[model samples]
Target: MAETSITSPHIMQIVGYKNTGKSTLIAALTRSLTFAGRKVAVIKHDGHDHFEMDHEGTDSYSFAQAGADAVVVMSEKRTALIERQAIPLEDMIKYLSRYDWILIEGYKQAPYPKLVMVREEKDLSLMETLQDAVGIVSWLEHDKSESMKDSEGLVRHSVHEAEDIARWLVSLECHEEKRRL
Candidate 1:
């Protein structure tokens, strides 16, 4: 994979095949980053053709079923908008640029700085095709050997080290901020 510049420094992606703990890692990162006083937003890619958000008996569900193009529900503390169409990732990122960190889950082919999850030896092949991979989160203990060095400056971390990974991501954000200054 060719080296790619970080176009959006606040964006970082966690990508891996199914059952590779990508969601778990992203959840951990969100909690840690939030506790550290950073505003974080997450965008997840669902490969499935359909996903359910509103329950069948809910008002939102009825509105959608009535062919409403968009349904937005708001309360004192939270708001959610469901559009009938798929929004492109770039547009979503632009809309969420106000957040201090946008930790994306999935979208493996995106050129953002990413931490690839490797569950086994075969999973390491993803590094060959993914662009701008900054690190690796491995599930297997011995998979951190030299054979895993698919790119220069790629750091390796165990799946258990969520706090360490969070710290690493925070440091990267700080470094990028400094570079921009």
Candidate 2:
């Protein structure tokens, strides 16, 4: 592992199976945070073998083809980095430390405070398997779903409760700042 050259940022993740509203929650959170004048960086964990972030004609891709090991392309609008191999979440977190908050989309096994999105009680089983879960986001607000108790201290929120979730993340950022000092 490469030595981490940056401080650990406030990190959280939304974890769930396909069609579980993970993307929805992430979008809402991003909008809310940006509106509140906070810089938020998101890292999506793609579990497919053919996840591509660069096109063949791009300079970054051309550099990679030339065995540069890592390629970085910077323009007035943005910068992109491409590496030869996958990077672990630990290192990615450091690389993104400049942001006020970092939200990950997958990596259920990652040991971070997680919000589990579920379609029904059956999917609640994932809570038991995850490394950590602080909250649950559900689209179903029926009595049956509410009756399904989550892990102790796990707060339940509706999928549309983006404002509430964003506030919670703000609180988390404050807490993380104290921890680093």
Candidate 3:
């Protein structure tokens, strides 16, 4: 993706332990937002391994290994890269400001508005650490056709349908708009 800068951007972080449907929720949310004509940006935090360059033998990887700060790898099909230095989350947000909203995956510890996935009762503790959680996505038992009624402080939705999550996001944006005005 071509790089662009953003400012005072709205962000939503999806966080939970492994297999709690965090990734699935993000995918649904993105699809929903995209269909709604809202531009969406995404960022994923990979806690398992150090950042690895894509296309290992590609020229871009070779350039980065040779100390190139930014290398763009392009083919007729697609393009990607491995880069040096860790860009802060804020900087990434700045880069994504052109989009209407940013949906971040797996930054459970970061201070951002969030739509956290909680599969079990034990995982709810994550809510304490998150700065502000706007919503929740759960795979647990609840009415699937509509938003869950039990979400006390925030909205809740089933992660099984992209449209449902998308509608929820739209609702969130609407609510935020009202609060801002």
Candidate 4:
């Protein structure tokens, strides 16, 4: 598979199968990173064929039904843009490149560094097939058992330790930044 080019200097992906807590981990990491004074942006891929961001009775929904290609809703506090199109992951990354960090929730095939979520021993098989896996966030009780041989050289963090995981991620980004310099 061809690697996805990442334009952002600081970006990481948290990827796993359904029910593996990728969303929860990303939320925690975003909170922790923002508290530490880092600007953070998040991009999540929805695997479903159809999803509705606006309710049927809402104005935005009405506009969409009226054949609007894009809808922009803005206020003093926040702004939302709904475009009727499929955006490539690389384009999204480039658009969000100004942030200090971008945490992506899926696109598992992308070549960016990722922390794979493992909820059971069977999930360990992912380690063997994925590229650029920097670490593992494990839900299994005994994450260090021999069953984890595939993750031997990668850092392991318990799923419950989001704060620690956030720290480790920041440190890894720092190390990579220095290496690039």
Candidate 5:
């Protein structure tokens, strides 16, 4: 099988501290992008340890015990997986290149265009830690703060302004497509 496959490739990532609405932002972005007739791929990094089998006695579980590094069990109805190994983010990105854009949840430190969700002053530094951060969506109001200012173009936006964000993201994608052409 091909390690990576794609057509037009662009990536946007959402990163933030726990419960800062990163998940909600991803959901909204997905909905808006889909509504606009764009195919989107998503990758989520889970920080937790261990995995559980939702289907305890399923064939996929048996293949996992038999030492399949990655098993993609597909049927007419659905699909499932049991895999091991640290799948590099780049590899995953390449695999999703077929989509118009890929939206990543977590992977805060990955070198990709990112939207950081922040709620407090302490979480502000994380924006710097992430690469290619284009903006921040915030729920807290910090008086006289420049947390979103940087050498790279930075946009400070309200989390509730979903339409604004969706428009901005669509514009960005349009610019990217033009550059490719």
Candidate 6:
């Protein structure tokens, strides 16, 4: 049998501490990007040893309990899969490369183009620990503050301003596309 595939890693990540609006920002960005005709794939970190897609007693979960290696639930509108395996981030990223943009929600330590979210004084130093940071999204009351002054050399955007962030990400994907060509 022949396998088919398509992937274009216009990859970027949104990293930050818990409750820092990473998920909110990603949801807004995904809505905006998809509305603008871009295919965006998102992978979220569960921050645990196990991740569950279906609730117990559901048909899919029952299949897994029966020792099925994979369970796929599909409807005319959408499809989801619950599988058992461990794949490295690099391999997973490559597997999902068949999209115009790949936006990651965690794995802060991974080396990739990132939009690091900063929300508190203590999180200020978190940015410095990130790799390949393209921009910082500030969730502070004021966009500029003494605490954030040390975060030099990265573009800053307000967390509440989701459209602006989405626009910036779209441009990043375009820039990467040119570089890839």
Better of 3 and 6 by TM-score: 6
Task: Show model 3 residue runs off by greater than 4 Å.
Answer: 1-9, 74-81, 143-151
Candidate 3 is scored at a TM of 0.79
Model 5, global lDDT: 0.77
User: Which of candidates 1 and 4 is the stronger one according to lDDT?
Assistant: 1
Provide the global lDDT of candidate 6 against the true structure. Answer: 0.78
Q: Among all windows of ten consecutive residues in candidate 5, which has the lowest summed lDDT?
A: 1-10
Off by over 4 Å in 1: 1-9
Please tell me which predicted candidate would have the highest TM-score against the true structure: 1
Worst 10 residues of 4 by lDDT: 1-10
Candidate 5 per-residue lDDT over residues 1-181, each given as its tens digit = 1112134666888899999998888888888877777777888888894557435587777877878788898889967665688778998887767887688998887888888888887788886567788888888665645645543578878889877887787777656766666
lDDT of all predictions? 0.85, 0.82, 0.72, 0.83, 0.77, 0.78
Give TM-scores for every candidate, taking all chains together and pairing residue i with residue i: 0.91, 0.87, 0.79, 0.90, 0.83, 0.86
Q: After superposition, how far is residue 6 of candidate 4 from its true place, in Å?
A: 15
Worst ten in a row by lDDT for model 3: 1-10
Each candidate structure's count of clashing pairs: 0, 0, 2, 0, 2, 4
Model 5 per-residue lDDT at 86? 78
lDDT by residue for model 3 (129-172), tens: 77778777777666441334454678776667658767666666
Residue 22 CA displacement from its true place in model 2, Å = 1.0
Runs in model 5 lying further than 4 Å from the true structure: 1-6, 51-54, 142-152
- In model 5, the Cα lDDT at residue 1 comes to 15
- TM-score for candidate 4: 0.90
Evaluate model 2: give its TM-score. Answer: 0.87
* RMSD for each of the candidates: 4.9, 4.9, 5.0, 5.1, 4.7, 4.8
